[model samples]
Target: MATQHPNALTRALAELPGPLPAFGVIHIAIPHTSRFTVVGNHLAQHAELSLVAIGIGVHIQSLPVGSLVGIKALTARFAEGEMRIAAALRELEAHGYLRRAHVRLANGRMATRTVFCNQPGALERAGRVVVAPKVPPAVPEEAPAVPEEPPAPPPAPEPDPVPESHPPVRVPPRTAPKPPRRPLPQPRELTPELRRTASAILADLRSHAKELVLSEDDIEELIPGVAAWLEREVRPDAIRHALTADLPKPPKYPAKIVRHRLTVLLPPPLPGAEELAPAAHRPLVIPLQNCDGCDRAFRSREPGRCRGCRDLAAAA
Candidate 1:
């Protein structure tokens, strides 16, 4: 019989490792009545997923698991840093959209495999039974059936002697010890002046850019750098100018952009009194002199005589 050829779509589908469920789209459920409420619920609890999570999620959804994109690549693609990418991934894992497992390979090597599931509970169900790579068991050639002998006698159990008891040995039941409570981290104390300066800088940035949005944590992190800038006598307007200069149209990731600009434009620290001491102690440069006779100006070690004039005077 002539073999029937598979169509293009069928061939493409067959080449895929497994079925593609949603084709290329991820559906986010939006409640008809309480849309904001549902979004706010996620934002409040999963703060790490707030800022760049949607972008990262969309990017990951487009690619297959075990694709060769690294953290650096993701950072470049999202225009954020490795920390942000890592935090977003952690958030995804925490929310059960992503999972990682070390699976044994056919070559006796172990490799980490990442599994992305559209449904949250899929990973949990998958965890119940591990599906490892199947290696075919080596089959030996079938041997001729052997005739078995059926007449073996069973051994009888021995009778127990009376047990001698000392006092009933008291053994305490083992119990797991309670975990020690971790000490709470102390809140970082900022001077009122530093706080005011940082607030002023942040306020100026907001006023200038309007697009820059920084959270309380972001503000706290940026305060020390702004404080240092203030210490160097950098003006507030300069800070604002530095932040908003050359901004992209409809700026994306404003916090990162602002932070990057602020870090890059921070004025170098002023030299200390010790650094100025050598220059201060150096001998002063004497003013240049013109010889009365020659009218030629020269640097005068001794006042008012050029070398020629001095030589002539010495000759006389």
Candidate 2:
């Protein structure tokens, strides 16, 4: 018998099937004309950097200068939580992709300054960049009696050029303070029974979904909506499923999500007994009876002979 064909080599030589999903990712890349960030394979293919870290670095680079990459800002924007984001930042810092320093401002408040280094290896060898030159102190003027050599003009020490990879660091200007988040409003006028049942269900939601752990205040705000579902005879388990199912990865606004689900997925109230249509009356089924003269079976409302048997008897 002939030897089996080489499957791997054949598949490799053949054109990739259009309809089929082949192994590995295929790129039909369009060259970017603008708004593009250049990333080196050193960073892109770092052996030690985690996927999260690589993503964060790229995101930071693509952002406009002075765009906030703080923990809170990142958590709100990306699916990764604060802890993971923080860890990724630290990873980038350790790998020389980023540097963070705490500096106290003129207003006596501390601020974190983050610097993105495109090529960390070059920056390390070149050392820190100097923004301004250090001027030598002027020589003290002596009296005419001891007029020795005239003092020379101070030599201006030229500052070192910024490393090829490290750009000039610029701090963002101070702006007006932001307003605090508005408080959530709790529902009122719900009956004790309904409120209790709905609250219980909401409170227990954390068990099924770790990300859905809502604050007590948020639960209070969302009670009315869940109670509405309960009024419509929706089961507690079903209510749980609707609120938690297919939720976005690492849901940031748990309260808003719960409130939205409760409002949108609420079932219509069941109709009352009187509102339901009465059962339709079915026609009575006749029983099979034997004919008196012919002993033939026939269907009749009451026990009687078949029509043929009755006609024969009449004739006789």
Candidate 3:
């Protein structure tokens, strides 16, 4: 019978010469002596990229030139769905890690060309340090010698107190202008009641999903958008569904997702709604007519027997 080491992990750990790291990653980096790729800390420690994007980016960087990095190819290679891969590729493209453009081939067929950047902004940094070539100084032309004029007496020194009156104006440092904020989508004006209703709907979203909890400020901010949906004859339940349905698992920045959905999925005003409004409220006018059976004036939609005569005839 073969004997096996029951506590293999414990035995292996005990064999280490030094005590284990306090906690966190212990780099057991082996210098690549053969085929390898170098990843910069910029990509490895990106603040905004998802783990999926970072892994996909590293995998792409490791692949040799001429390797297929298309969305379809990547979907086949990774366990992630097509949407996640596409989103990762988009993230890479947006952050200057990748670029894709269609190009016409020699045979007139269109082909997509992709570019990968290991280090973004390197070109801009290099461009900023360009050295201008030195130019030769021009020779001075000979001029007739003239009698030297006496140097003008130095102007009397200006009084310090007078200068202080016109103190050097310290100009504030200029900064880049912030992009204009997009206005909330309000298809129609909201009544006070509508605003209250909208507020209630937003406040109750947390009941369905804990991740959808919104602060008072968020609820206030989103009220107009929800009210706008309500103004379009959209139901409160529908508004809740639009904001909460298909939410990301364990939503991070749930407010941002809600805001995006509010803007993108906003329904248009019901078509011909304005035109049909007056007709619904219009008074129903029935011209006075003499009943043919009773020969008496009665209010009816058309020339028909009065209700009393119809009832009596039915009884008979």
Candidate 4:
């Protein structure tokens, strides 16, 4: 026994007996540079055809080898050896369906190739021309607007929650503290030298009141004697030697022996002699170098002798 041959509604559709319905599919293989018109002419002359998907640079997932695809009047280029849109038509072809081809052309220029196919149906399987089923006109439906819930039923009248409890507490008021006081200190006493200078200044102010008032300056000059006294006190021996050296002659008295001679040279107060005692006394010996009767500290005719001593020596 021989195996049965497959029915081809798809193959018969590829070779249409008349003009194509407004919509159909096509599948075919085309040369690289062949225009869409060649493919479309082959379709119009042979296969039934209609609408297809369209866009420039559109991409398809799978295809039969050497088949051209059409999107609307545009003939999509085949992927060379791969068939496009065939994956979508595989099951239909398996069940003995027919396919149609159409080529797109405009202004005598080829645009794209197309393929047409029939959906499986009782009329198609029975091998007779059947008109496509007409779709019923669509009816518009109006929806009723729903009323919003009445403000959520006034929040369900919630009861007041119980109050919280805690123990009572107290805080004391604060007061500012005062600063401690420091005692005032006493003044220091003035020194003796400072007191003396202050007294002298006061005396000057009193005495020179008019002058100070006139010029606001109190200038007090040192007395000449005070300066001399200071010089003498500071250099007593120098002053004494200078005075003695400048005198015309040396004194007859030995400064140390004169005091001792004073008593002997004077007599006690006598009745009548008291008045004459001072004058009657041997004229106190004033030492001279001329007088030899006394130490030779003074110059006189009689060395170391006074005037009286010289007279006594002459009488001798």
Candidate 5:
């Protein structure tokens, strides 16, 4: 069986509507140099925009204004939170790359218009294009003129009295005695040395942890504890060991940790007389002067030595 061709079998074909005119394509021109300009401009630093901010700016330039789906689209595309998108938009506006104006429409409608610019000067140009409503001139009313009064005549001159001369007395001028200058207080004997030690320790810790950032004030405050520990005959290595022990990985608040350890590990004060007194009659003893070695107040029969110094000397 020979099948007849469908085109040969058809008697007539209805004409199809002429192909609809192809919709016009929208082409947006973005300069490649914009990337260099955006990063090199002072606005980038002033606005403190991260890579997220740059992404948001590029999208804003490409997308249509007042797009309700922009937030969701940006979130999906950039893998960022809505708040971050909003913040980036704010940064762009702050740096003059974006502007929003509330405009009243011809039909008494209000709309928010978003304007994006590649350069800051475009914002000024956009602003100038908006013509302000002309204000009518006000005709000021004339004030009544005030009459001027004539000047009064000068008074008559009085007669001068005869001059009386007296011998000028020679008096010595009193002079104030200059105040004595008080000597400036000298720096503490241990402060400079302890400060140097503190600086070295802080530098070492920063190198090791990279997170331990201490200011000069923090170092100054911490040095006193270090000095106290040194005065108590504790070795610097011991202090370092104590600080570094049991530290968390990438320790948080290193200054706080150091301070806590320094305070908690401080040696207890030397035993008082109450501890040395006999069980039968415990008498109260008052410390007379500070120890020469550690500057700790203690009751001692000797002139210069505290009990700790005496013990150290005996051990030596």
Candidate 6:
């Protein structure tokens, strides 16, 4: 029979020889949707690695830190791409999945630092009650009551004062003020896939030059991926073009009027050759023929009058 050893975290901590550090909660992500912030305090210096071991231990035990997990498991799972993985972290943070670990440093100052996925299980969900505001009950009106006065009494005496001497007093000067705070560091923005998407959109538009009519279904399907890509990777100009191009222009008039009067007028292109007038005499004569009206056979295209005469008549 095989002997089961304690978890890596427990084993590591057991191996530690001296006093632990005065560190506070070390936030970690719980692998699943259980709402909690896992705290692994490393009392000693190298405990962070132990914490990592603990996290794996807890993860293997199926007790994930829930609060740090906002996305579906499939979306939150680790990928090889740094940008994608970072993007997943950002998404989680934006949606309140994970927060910066506010740990108490040994020097007694509180500092917020980053960790990959801090999830604390039971502690994260403790007593978070949403109390609705209460509406006070109405009071009934009543009649006013009469006021009452009071009486007076006797007075008393005084005491003597002593000769006072002054003692040397000391005053202290104010301490120098601390410096101004700098802005928080901004996390990275987008991933390579997003950039690729944006580039693809621009390429597609340039390649397909036509206004590129898309059906509602197509737009709906493509919009999310495009928007995500633009948000993450594309340059401002390219993103602008990708988003605004081919989108419906704002109404010329008020929206109400535009919506009410809007009509989809997809009229056909101007009629084709078959719709134009047929030749006057079926087999059109090249040389002039007789004009039945004046019994003339002119050797010209129009025949009615010679071509020059016909032109002059029309002009006249």
TM-score of each: 0.28, 0.34, 0.35, 0.14, 0.25, 0.16
Instruction: State which candidate has the highest TM-score.
Output: 3
For model 2, how does the per-residue alpha-carbon lDDT over 1-316 read when each residue is reduced to its tens digit?
9999878655643543344234433323333435455566677778899999999988876665567888899999999999999999999989888887566655335887777776787667867522111212322223233233322223334443232233445443234354443332233447899999989999999999888998899988888888777777789999999988988898999888887677655677799865685656544578899888688889997887899988878999
Q: Taking the tens digit of each residue's C-alpha lDDT, what string does model 3 give over 64-131?
A: 55678888999999999999999999999889788654545443347766767666677346432111
In model 3, the worst 10-residue window by lDDT is 128-137
Q: Candidate 4's residue-wise lDDT over 220-291, tens digit each? A: 221121123222232333322332332223433332122222222222223554555777574655544644
Which residue segments of model 1 deviate by more than 4 Å?
1-190, 272-281, 284-316
Q: What is the C-alpha RMSD of each candidate to the true structure, in Å?
A: 26.1, 25.4, 30.6, 62.1, 33.9, 34.9
In candidate 2, which residue ranges exceed 4 Å CA deviation?
Answer: 1-23, 102-111, 129-316
* CA-RMSD of model 1: 26.1
**Which 10-residue window of candidate 5 scores lowest in summed lDDT?**
129-138
Q: What local lDDT score does residue 35 receive in model 2, on the 0 to 100 scale?
A: 48
- Over 26-103, each residue of candidate 5 has an lDDT whose tens digit, in order, gives 222222312221122333334477767777775554443344435677788777899998788877888777666565
Question: Candidate 3, after superposition: displacement of residue 233 in Å?
Answer: 0.6
Query: How do all the candidates rank in terms of TM-score, highest first?
Result: 3, 2, 1, 5, 6, 4
Give the C-alpha miss distance for residue 141 in model 2, angstroms: 60
Residue 50 lDDT, candidate 6, scale 0-100: 41
